[model samples]
Target: MSTNSRWWFADLVLVVGLASFSGSIALTGLDGPLRVAFVLPLVLFLPGYAFISAIFPEAGNDDTRKFGSDKSEAIYAVGGPERVGLSVTVSVAIVPLVAAIANFTPWGIRVLPIVIGVLGFTVLSALGAFVRRWRVPANQRYSIGLPKLLFNSVGRHSNGSTTMVNIGIVISLLLVTSSVGFAVLSQPTGQQFTEFYVEGQNINSNTNTFYQSNLGDNGITVNVGNREGEQTQYTVIAVLERVENGSVTEQNRFDQQQVTVQSRQTKQVTLNGNPSLSGDNVRVRLLLYKGDPSGSPYRVIRLWLSS
Candidate 1:
């Protein structure tokens, strides 16, 4: 291919791969199939590929192969294989590193933040790859070998027999397809929601303590967790009630709040209550309404706290 064509084509892999990855973030509601289509490749390999290309743009040049006799070529090449290997290794680590940092923020470990972080890295690396290639002499500019390396190796053997090679390719494709399907199925559907009692005055967090003074002073904490892939409205109502074996008596409302939680995040709402709720085996009920608190709750948590 011509130089201009090669440059444009080479750039497309990183550009489109990341675009596809980020686009999948919006598909969080679609679940399984979309996941297999986009998420895994971006998470597992694309970042590494981009970074490696940046540092070792020539790894895919005519001189090297990732396996067999050519495996050591990257080491012996002008850049040296060790540096190339390190680039590849660090590229892989980028995903987890971004995820760990994002988790501490409001984003958590959700699809959007992770994808954006990776795509940012991917774009930077792609730019580096372009610069690195641009400096190379005209004669040395070679096509990337990844496609040939992965797709071509499927069935060919030293002897190059067509029958065996064809069969091997078929088997390999089948395994890959099966693995992808399994991954999609095995991945947790980042859906559903959770409602739990939290420490007094902090609805967004769990204190794990029951007797918090805020629990009875017209103050209550209810945390609602949503992984529904979009902004969801929820109503949290804390009801103070007493149940007498096979009978119920005297229910009073202590606190109520309407709040919204982003997809793949948790939000806490501290409602108001009086200290009278303390002691006497009072049942503190936390009801989470998906859209309307007055309507049936999607989840309910009953906690018995002593003031």
Candidate 2:
């Protein structure tokens, strides 16, 4: 038991170390392939492995977990492939469950809380696994002997130059795999759309609060950015409205313009209005349409001209 055996020691240390390192990378907002590679295992494998290890700490037959049989007489353990499959399955279940639970909490399902939740669960499960393994007899407990066997095989052929070349090849393969995986995972797959906004007369002007008297002399500016994955033709219509008690009492069309913008480019349209609108919360509404302005507007932006 724990008095003499430490075979599970290294396994527990690796679990805790990986959890801490990945947690640090996430919390520090580090980005790129290295972070993705490290954190991927944390999310997809480690927690489930720790959970399974905690549940089954012995390296023996599957009869150990059978109901109603004598507990001490049998051991339930899994081989490497079975362990890996179980870990992935359990991790998939755990992550979403944790997220669902986090959805109700004050922190919601955000990065910080998820990292903390997963990290905490992993570390605690690892500790439980260690304790369970420690309580079992050394011969009956699960141990990672594959790495020792590999190390011994390498040591047998440790000629100076060949070993260095093997190590280099392995590192190179890992780096390449990590880079490709990150690229595939990080591709931009979001929806393509145009960005439309209203700005005051100048770059430094605030569009939210405008004086009605100065609007006729210095008109507002509308900017359109094409992120639609292609060149696009856009129609902009500007309207001045006077609203009293949440209802528009007077509405006047001010300006209309049509412009073509290339993908990843922006265009500005000037809207000048001479309508005699005098009141609090006078709105300058800009309607944006793609190609045809006959149907409903594709996007709408409003600016309040304060009295």
Candidate 3:
């Protein structure tokens, strides 16, 4: 085959591979299958374009050359065997890297930042590809090659080292400003509390633990209103630890912590309901107080209720 033909064939395979890889990442990262439906067409089209390009090689050389020659074009030059090896290497390496990072990270809510970072990187990579293409000169512009299209759709945007340094400085300034705001906000603010109500009338304490069990029992069941205006019985599986001076001393089991109710009703059974109730109609009031815990320096809360 001629160099032109060889180049075209290589371009075609590279585009298809990239599209496939990007589609895989998108499908994996995203929550739903809807993206796959949208991406399948593009995936199919990449190879299809290659086939058509082979048949009609002379039709659109300028556009093709422009779009196909971006950063992705360089990666495609590594022969077929090398290309496969690169793919395998990336796939194998990513898992352990993620695992190692996660292992070193702190537990509880603090780990959220790391998770957000990973997602941000993926998004930024996709965005960067598009930004690069957009910044390219019009005269030097290329056709919509498959790899460019996929990366443009999926990667993050970043200026090279210099731009990144500037961005870091800007981000540091913003963070400093935010820290000042947080410090101002955190100082000796009056206590704030959220109130949730539980419907007492429909609640059947006989079958539920609230009537039968003592403190630190297995579970408590309560009834709350459902979407249809009918009352539905729900079981509160855990109890909230009492808050003293704005902090919860103990953690409750998962089952008794929160009661799930239908969206239609505004009232939710609080874990801190009254422990003493003899009559059929008993009102349970739960109060949740928030405060900072000792040593950890993290703010926490405890719950208390009266029936």
Candidate 4:
């Protein structure tokens, strides 16, 4: 057969071989073997095309006459419709292959090869077609270097489209993945806590000072005093309860009993819990450990009752 016919046949064989292998892998769900199977065909095809062209220099001569005829014109030789069409076909085919590979790997590693392969094919094909159309004279467009010329031309245009498409797809994928991850993290587990209260008293008179109601039942609020003009830290050790007339009520509700106080500074403490305070008189004591009680450093602890 003529060199041109041989070259075309080789191209057809390579394309068919790759397509068949890809389809088989997709159908059979064989990931590891597929990765290796793709390499040999690619290696063989390029050399085979070159060898065929060398043997039939007449075909190459024709390509040169047809495309190399123009050196000065700003030909849209790279991004022509035919090249664009081929690239689109390759890209579209890759999506399904990627999906199939992704089925095998939740991590999505398998999909990467498909994407790379598709992109490489599109780029190489476009470039080859472009070089063929541009470097050869108009009459000698079928030269041995035609493939290179065609690819070079098409490569320039497809690159811009490829970049835009790839970036958009990647960003969309990341957003979807992140949203799913966040949803999985927001589920609740069952748990409950015990009720308690804290009361404030005047150290001088040993008398009830500022009496506050149930601090645990609903929520507790306490005012920490800083007398020494320094920073202080307090740790709440226990919750105390008080009983009155006929019902029980939280006397002093301390959301935060133990708190660090800056010298001469005082802040209100708030705690969440169910305190039963529904009587005439009630007093609750909160045991506290003071640490650097005169410092401005403080950390909030969330208390939960174990039920």
lDDT against the true structure, per candidate, is: 0.59, 0.72, 0.36, 0.40
lDDT of 2 by residue, 1-307 (tens): 1223465567777878987888787665344566677777777678898998898787653344544445433336554445555776787678788888889999998777888888889999999999998888776677666533122221123466744654554455456546656664565757578999865543334545666666787777788998775678999998889888999989989888899987667899887767567677688888999997988999998777765
Top lDDT model: 2
Best by TM-score: 1
lDDT of 1 at 262: 71
Better of 1 and 2 by lDDT: 2
Quickly count the clashes in candidate 2: 0
Which wins on lDDT, candidate 2 or candidate 3?
A: 2
**Model 3 ranges off by over 4 Å:** 1-96, 107-115, 130-234, 237-258, 261-307
Task: Please give the RMSD to the true structure for each candidate, in Å.
Answer: 7.6, 11.8, 17.6, 20.7
Please report, as a residue range, the 10-residue window in candidate 4 with the lowest summed lDDT. 189-198
Arrange candidates by lDDT, descending.
Answer: 2, 1, 4, 3
Model 2: colliding residue pairs: none
List TM-scores for all candidates, in order.
0.54, 0.51, 0.26, 0.22
- Clashes found in each candidate (C-alpha, N, C closer than 3 A): 10, 0, 25, 78
Give the poorly placed runs of model 1, Cα more than 4 Å off: 1-30, 55-117, 144-174, 177-181, 187-193, 200-221, 227-237, 242-249, 252-263, 267-283, 288-307
Error of 1 at 73 (Å): 9.9
